[model samples]
Target chain A: MYLVEKLGEKTIELFHSIFEIVQFLLLIFLHLVNPKSYNPAMRMVLTKQIYFTAIGIIPIFILMAIIFGSVVIGVVIYLSTAYSLESEIGSIIITFVVDEFAPFFTALLISLRSGAAINTEIAVMSVNKELNTLKEYKIDIIDYLFLPRIISGIISVTSLSFLFALIMLGSGYLFTFFYMDMDFNTYKYLLLNAIELRDILTLIFKSFAFGFVIMLIPIYSGLKTQNHYTAIPVSVLNGMVRLFVAVFFIEVLSLIIQFF
Target chain B: MCENIALIKAVHENMSISEANTLAVEMLSMIGLQKIAYKRVENCSKDELLLVMFIRALMTKEKSVILKLPSEIIGGLFHIENILKDMRKVNTSKEIFVCDLVSSKAYYKECECHIEESN
Candidate 1:
C-alpha cells in the first residue's frame, strides 16, 4: 500500500511537470512572435547569449566533432566493407551520423555546458533579488531574460547540429581516401545520391525540438529554486537530469517517427 | 553600475542602446559617480550600491520615492544627511519619503526630508 501510494504520487508529479513545461513553452512562443519583446535590452542579451553558447564553444565543438566523426565514420566504413556493403556507406553515414548522432551529441554537450550555467544564473538572480529589481521598474523579465536564452539555445543547437553534420561528412571522405583509396568525386557522388529531402527536414525539426527543451527545462528548473543560496546547486542538478531525459526522449521520438 | 539604471529605460521604454547608455552615464554624473559607469556590481562600495539602487528606483518614472531603511540597506555606518545631499544633487522633483524604525528616528532628525514614523 505504501509502494502504491508512492507510485501514484510520482505519476502525478510527472504529469504536473509536463503541464507546467507546456504552459511555459506556450508563453515563450507568444513572446517570441511579438516584435515588442525584441527591445534593445533583449537584443543585447540575445547577442551575448549567442556569443556565449554558440561562438565561444566552436573551437572545442569542432575539435570534438573531428575526433568523434573520424572514429565513427572509420568504424562504419570498415564494417560496411567487411559485410561487402560498401555501396551503402553513404546511406549508412547519413542515417546514423547526420540524421541521428549530430543533433543528439550537440544537444548533450550544450545541455552539460550552457544549460547548467543558465540554470545557475537564473537561480542566483532569483536568490539575489536581481529579478525583483527588474520587476520593480516594470521591466519584463520574460522579455529581458528568458526569451533571449531560449532563442539562443534554439539557434545554437540548430546551427551547431548542421555544422556537426558537415564535419562528419567531411571526415568521412578523409577516411575513405586514406583507408579505402576512394576518390573524392566518387565519394561525393555516393553521398549526394544517398541524400534525401526527408533527412534534412528531420534534422531541422529534431534540432529545433532539442534546442527548445534543453533551454526550457533548465530555465524552468532554475525558476523552481527556492529563494536560498543552497537551492542553486539543487536546481542545476534537477535541470541537468531533466535536460538529458528530454534530449533522449526527443531522439527516441524522432526515431520512432522515422521508423513509421 | 550604470547599466543597472539604464536597463529599465532600455527594456521598458524601448530606448536605443547608445541612447540609454548615454542617459545612464548622465544620471551617474548627476551623483558624481560617472567614473564608475563601467564598474561591475561586486567591486562597488556599499554606499555606491545603495546609490545605484536609488538611481534605479528613480528610473521607474514614479513621482514619489519611499526609501525603506536606508542605513540597513547600506549595511554600514552612513549619514542620512549625505544621502539626502546626494539625492538633492540629482535634483529630481520626486517626493522623497524615508521610512525607518521609530527607535532610529533620531538618525533622520537632521535630514531635510519628511519621515513617517510607525509604532
Candidate 2:
C-alpha cells in the first residue's frame, strides 16, 4: 500500500529508481570528462558551493556537536567511573561518538539544511522557468549549478563532520575530567588508543555518501516533475523520505561491506 | 451511456467548467486515454480547459465516462467554448495530457483556483 499504481506502474518505476540514483554519479563523471563545457565563472560556482554547504552549516553543526558531545561525555564518564570500567571510556567515545553518531548527526544536519535548500530551490526554478531561462542564455545549467553543489556537498559534509567529531571528542574529554575521577591524560589515552585508519575512512565515506544522496535525490525529483504546483510539495516530501532511507541504507550497507 | 452521463453530471453537477477541467486531468491515466484517444471530439490545448475535462473524465467510477461527457457537464460551454475543441482530441490518459497540457499548458494559476458547481 505504500505505492499506488500510477498508470498501473509502480513496480517498474521502482526499478527505474536505480537510474535516478545513478544520475548524480553520471553528472559528476560527465562534468569531469568535459571540463571545458563548464568554463563560465568557475569562481562563482566554487564560492557559492562552499558558502552553501560549509559556511551556512558552521553555527548549527557546532552548537549541536557541543551540546550532544557534553551530554554524552557526562553520561559515559559517570557510568564508566561508577562501574570501575573507566578504561573502556576511550573505546566508547571512539566507537559511539566518532564512528557512529557524530558523522551521522553532522550529515543529517547538513543534509536537512542543504538538502532542503537544493530541493526547494530547484523546484522553484523549475516552476518559475528559471531553469529554462538558463538554457536560453547558453549556460550549462547542470554543469555549473548542480555539479558544484554535489562537489561542495561531499567535501563540506566530510570536513564538517570531521570538525564536529573533534568538537565532540573535546566535549567528551571536558565532561569526564570535571565530572569524574578521570584526568586529561587518561581521557587522551583512551581516544588515541581507539584511532585507526579504517575508522576515519569509514567516517569520510559515510559523510560524503549521505550528503550526496540527500541533494541528488531532490534534484532528480525536481527534474522529473511535470506541472503540478501541488506535485512540487509532494516531490519534496518524497525526496526527504527517500533521503533518510538512503542514509540508513548506507549505514547498513557500509557495515556489511566492511565486515565482508 | 446513461452511467457515463450520470458520472459526468455528478462530476460537473455543482462545479464550474474550470473545476471540471482540473478533475479531468487528475482522473485520467495514460492507458485509459490511449484506448480511447481517436474517439475524443474536443482537443484542449490550454491546461485550464483540459483540467476541467480531465476532472470530469475521472470523477466517476463508470467505465464509459469519457464516451458520454454531456450529462456530467452543464451550461458553461458559452464561456468555455474556446477550450471545447481541445477536449475532442483528448485520449483520456496522463501521457498526452502531460505532453499537451500539463507540460506545455501549465501556467501558475495567478488567481485562486476557482470552482463552482451548479447542483
Candidate 3:
C-alpha cells in the first residue's frame, strides 16, 4: 500500500510538471502572437534580462570556453595520434564540442546563475504578496514579466551558444597550431568540412529549446511557491535541478533527432 | 499600488500619452501630490502611494474594486473616508471592497457588507 501511494504521488507530480510546462509554453506563444505584448515596459524587461543573463557573463564565458576548447583539443590530439586516427579529429570535435557541449554548457551556466536568481526573486515576490498586488491591478504577470524573460532567455542562449562554438573552434585551432604544428588552413578546412547543415540546425534548435526550459522551469517553480518565506529556497533548488535535467534531456533529444 | 495605477491609467484606459499625463496631473493635484507625480514610487511616502493606488482603482471605472488597505492607512480613517467620498462623486455605482485587519473594523462601519476572518 505504501509503495503504491508513493508511485501514485510521483506520477501525479510528473503530470503536474508537464502540465505547467505546456501551459507556460502556450502563454509564451500567445504573448508572441499578440502584437500588444511588445510595450515599452516589456522592452525594458527584455533588455535587462539579456544584459544580466548574457552580456554580464561574457568574460567568464569566454575564458571558460577557451579553457574547455583547449582541453578537449589536447585530449583529441593525444588520443588521435596514439590510435592513428588523426583524420577523425575534426569530426569528433564538431560532433561533440560544437554541436553538443556549446549549448549544454551554456544552458548549464545560465541555469546556475540566472535561473536560481529568477526563481528566488519570483518566489519572494509571491511570498510578499507582490504577485497579488499585480493581480489586483489587473496586470497580466505572464505578459509583463514571464514573456520578456522567456524571449530574452531564448535570444541570449542562442547568441551565446553561437559565440561559444565560434570561440571554441578558434581555441581548438590555436591549441593545435601551437602544440601540434597543424596549419590554420588545414584545421579550418577540416572543421568546416566536418560541419553539416543538419548539425547547425540541430545546434540552433537545442539552444532555443534549452533556453526556453531554463527560464520556464524557474518561473514555474517560483510560481509554485506558497505565501511562505521557506518556500523560496525550495523553489530555487527544485528549479535548478529541473533545469539541469531539462538541459541534458534537450541535448540528448537533439542528438538523437540529428543522427537517428 | 502606485505601479498599478500607472499601468491602468496608461494602458487599460486607452488614454493617449498626453491624456494619461493630464489625468495623472489631475489626480495628483487632488491628492496634493502634483509636485511628485513624475517621481519614482520608491521615493514616494506610504500615504502618497496609497492615495495614488486609491485614485487609480477609482479611475479604472470597473464595476467592482477590491483594495487591501495597509495598516498605516487604517489609522487615517478620516482621510480614507474623504477619499471614498470623492470616489463616490466620480463613481457612485462602483462597489469597493476594503480588506483590513480585525483591529481596523471600526473604520468600515458604513460599509454594506463586512466579512471578518480570525487567525
Candidate 3: list runs displaced more than 4 Å: A1-17, B1-6, B9-44, B55-119
Higher-ranked by lDDT: 2 or 3: 3
Looking at model 1 chain A, which ten-residue stretch has the lowest summed lDDT? Answer: A130-139
lDDT of 2 at A154: 81
Cα-based RMSD of the predictions, in order?
1.8, 17.3, 5.3
Candidate numbers sorted by TM-score from highest down:
1, 3, 2
Per-residue lDDT over A1-260 for candidate 3, one digit per residue giving the tens place of the 0 to 100 score: 99999999999999997887787778789888897877655665678899999999999999999998788878877888789888888888888776888888899988888889999988988898888877877777887789888888899999999999899889988878987799999999999889988778777888889888888989988998977898788888888888888887887777677779
* DockQ of each two-chain model: 0.82, 0.01, 0.18
lDDT of 2 by residue, A1-260 (tens): 43565744866787787775676568667775675634434334656788978998788778888998899778877887789876777776787776788778877887688887787778877887768845643456776567777777788888888898899999887787677757888778778997888788889888878767766777776776666577778778877787788888988898788678
lDDT of 2 at A219: 76
Please give the C-alpha DockQ score of model 3. Answer: 0.18
Q: Pick the candidate with the highest lDDT.
A: 1
Query: Given the true complex, what DockQ would model 2 score?
Result: 0.01
- The TM-score of the first chain in every model comes to 0.95, 0.88, 0.93
lDDT of 2 by residue, B1-47 (tens): 11221234332243433444344433343213332322333443333
Which parts of model 2 are misplaced by more than 4 Å? A1-8, A37-40, A81-84, A258-260, B1-119
Report the lDDT tens digits of candidate 1 across residue range A1-260. 99999999999999998798789889989999999999999999999999999999999999999999989999999999999998898899899887999999999999989999999999999999888877777788889999999999999999999999999898888999999999999999999999999989888999899889888888888888999999999999988998898899999999899997
Model 1, stretches more than 4 Å misplaced? A1-11, B115-119
